[model samples]
Target chain A: MRDNGAMQHSARRDDTAAQPSRMQSAVFLPIGDEGRAELVERRIAEAITGGLIPAGERLPSESALARSLRVAPVTVREALVALRDRGLIVTRRGRNGGSFVADSADPAQFTAKRLGAMSRVALRDLGAHYSAITRACVGLAAARADASEVARIRQRLANADAADEKAWRRAADEAQTEIAALSQSARLTREQMRLQAEFSPFLGLIGQDASAREQQRRAVLAVLDALERGDADAAASAVDAFVRDSVALLIDHQMRLHRA
Target chain B: MKALQATDAPAAVDTVTAFFQRGVDALGEGTRELAADVASARAEGPLTRAKLDAIVLPYAQALFDRAGVTVYGAGFIAAIGLLNDASGHLSWWQGPRHSKLELAAQNIGKEHIDYSELEWYRVPVSTGKPHIAGPHVDYLCSDEYTITVAYPVFVGGEFIGVHGMDVLLDAVEGELLPLLSGETEEITVINAVGRVLVSTNPHRATGDPVRDAGDTLTRYECEGLPLAVLVS
Candidate 1:
């Protein structure tokens, strides 16, 4: 019996050690620092993006985690609190108690309603960043993209065409997301996604002008064409020009509306 | 002689099952009542500490009793009082453990556990994926063992948690085996950390890590189970 217990203990230890490998294969980056709350937060975020932490899953309790990590319970609590404020996790009390991850995917209409709640500056800043980042993405895509990726970009443009103003906005957003995804950099993709979420509400507020929409579509197509041609410099320059012009147009429109 | 007799007899799995089933039912009912109380409290405006406890404690106690579960060596609700801020004062509202758990259960029958509170649930500055908390299970049968089940919970068009019950295996082998159907397949529950919370086969109850269970007749298999359905 004692031998059985000892063997079981050793096996369990091996299993625990093996668990990290399983997570690593699934794209979850192991947290490095013991006490740094930021490292914990970043690891959780990466896990979420990597799909290791599925939507609506709960986190471990503070006491349980503290013991496992060899850290103070307070540190765990602090990290959880930070996650909660970001609207990532929700908490409850009573017999069934714990925290859970929140789902970010919502319909276009829902996204629009949320966007309507943003401050003016938030919207403006978001527009600026989207314009800038998207432009960079298109340019990079033009230089480094392959035939299949370029085909995917064209399909996104077609989706944009099929959508209404709101739907088009969503399609455009998806297109930008795909661009980041194609970059194959988990860190860069996360950063861009964060920026996009922050400015989503403002992006929804932008008016749908037929001529402007057509111009944007043409610009995107042209950028894709440059990438397909392998003209990296030209593609980058075109994207830069498009972003500069779009920013100016948006700023001018906003100023005119304010003046009126 | 009585204590020896009790120990000599195997623990009853039926009793353990009944205990857990009763506990889950009680928790579910208590959650509904708590939801109503929270709504009323919110409507009453900023609540004093006394009023909050006055409203919550009774219901919490009732919940623990109904579930046949104890906390801090007493009914589970008593454990609520132990959570204190740096000042040693009861700090319920400062954390969202209760709210998140309640919401998770209500929204999805799953409960979430957090190892780090200060980093995940802090106010103001936020870090990590705001919508993604961390790795957690949607269902928990017990602190040690959990079973995966079909049929997820969806509230307000969202998956929240999972629902299941746990049984103490030693007790089952000792007392409940005689009561169970002869053809009843072996059952066992394991938590995220791979601890055996309960089991039906007496030979499986070694009080060791669950992952160590080899292909012995006493060992149970739980492959292809959803990670969300286990205790984490």
Candidate 2:
């Protein structure tokens, strides 16, 4: 009877282990380059957030991750790098130490530092640079943008128009970045993304007036219309004009505050 | 002695006119060569840094020589391939004239003359049209102005560039006006669009809209003139 009980207990433990392992495998089926990295990092982060991988729980070895995911060790490394950048995982060198979820992470510090950097940059100069780049992108987009790209831009613009000031600013940032990406110039897109990151904090500080924001929405729509019409020159001009006007408004407001 | 001096004045005038005509002719030839050189050079790609320098330095030197005439300044187009893409390269150059030309043009659109102001479109050597010296003349000469010449560089009937020169009233007032036998007529050379390209009178000069009203004096003169010479 005792031997029978021992067998039953061992079988129950095996079943308990098999269920989560199977669920995890199902949750993370690595696909392509970006998809694989995203899946691993997302799974790891969610596990930590949900206390599934509790603080101080050592993550699986890189080799083990590779074996389980049927992906290369390099992908595991990339996913770890992303999680490290986010401050969710800490790695140490020693016999006992591997990667472990951090016990505490302060999101407030991350946000404050990001915002403070933005506040220091002059909005007017940012506007000018933004204008120059976006104009170039719009011109290029008119020539090369595919149907899916057009739909994405239209969707972003709609989101921007319907959003409140804060939401609009964020949506505007994404839309501009998307437009730059549509140009298919990696260098241009990288530079624009950097600019957007630099501007984010100050964008949160200043509120765009409703009328001006509405006008900007209209201008973006006009650009989309030009794109739809397949008028490259007009699209370029419209984008350039919108950038100039938006920059002017930002500069005017900043100057007024300075004078007062 | 009186007859000798009178004859000398007409002879001097003829000589000056001949010299100007020769300079204009030489400019035309040089411009054609430059355009051909530009087209060939830009065919493969934009003129390289060394080649662009090679072209512009000599062209600018020639422009400065022409500006040395009674006219205060001259500017020409220099095409450089700055933007290159799948569509190939587009290149052009403009003016190497006085730096103040930019400042003077900027003063026109404003209510008050802001001395510190600088306008990008006004820059003397800037590639865009309504070249600086033309606008400068318009600001300085009013409705009583006359004679603005924009000698554009054409190669094979296409306007590849321009060499703008103006003869304003102020420059002529102290010297040439007294010599004319008839009443001093206001001759304004306007571009096809009616923007005063150049004028002898200071008031009708800079930034003033072209008046196409019933007034025959300023009724868009010079329709028959070459489009290359008209300033608007």
Which digits, one per residue and each the tens of the lDDT, describe model 2 over residues B102-147? 2211211111221111111123224322222222212221211323
Worst 10 residues of 1 chain B by lDDT: B129-138
Can you write out model 1's per-residue Cα lDDT over B1-232, one digit (the tens) per residue?
A: 0112222322333343454444445545544454455446646675443454565555444533443543211011211122232111221210112221222212111122221121112211132111111111111112221121112222333322211122233333344345443524555544333444445555554223344444432322232221111111
Each candidate's lDDT (Cα)? Answer: 0.43, 0.49
Off by over 4 Å in 1: A1-140, A161-163, B1-232
> Residues A171-191, candidate 1, lDDT per residue (tens digit)?
555555555444333344556
Measured against the native two-chain assembly using Cα atoms, what DockQ does each of the candidate structures obtain, in the order listed? Answer: 0.01, 0.01
Using lDDT as the measure, the top candidate is: 2
Error of 2 at A22 (Å): 85
Q: Model 2 chain B — which ten-residue stretch has the worst lDDT? A: B108-117
Q: Report how far residue A228 has shifted in candidate 1, in Å.
A: 1.4
Candidate 2 B-chain TM-score: 0.41
**In angstroms, how far off is B129's CA in candidate 2?**
14
Candidate 2 runs further than 4 Å off = A1-260, B1-26, B36-46, B67-182, B198-205, B216-232
Per-residue lDDT for A189 in model 1?
53
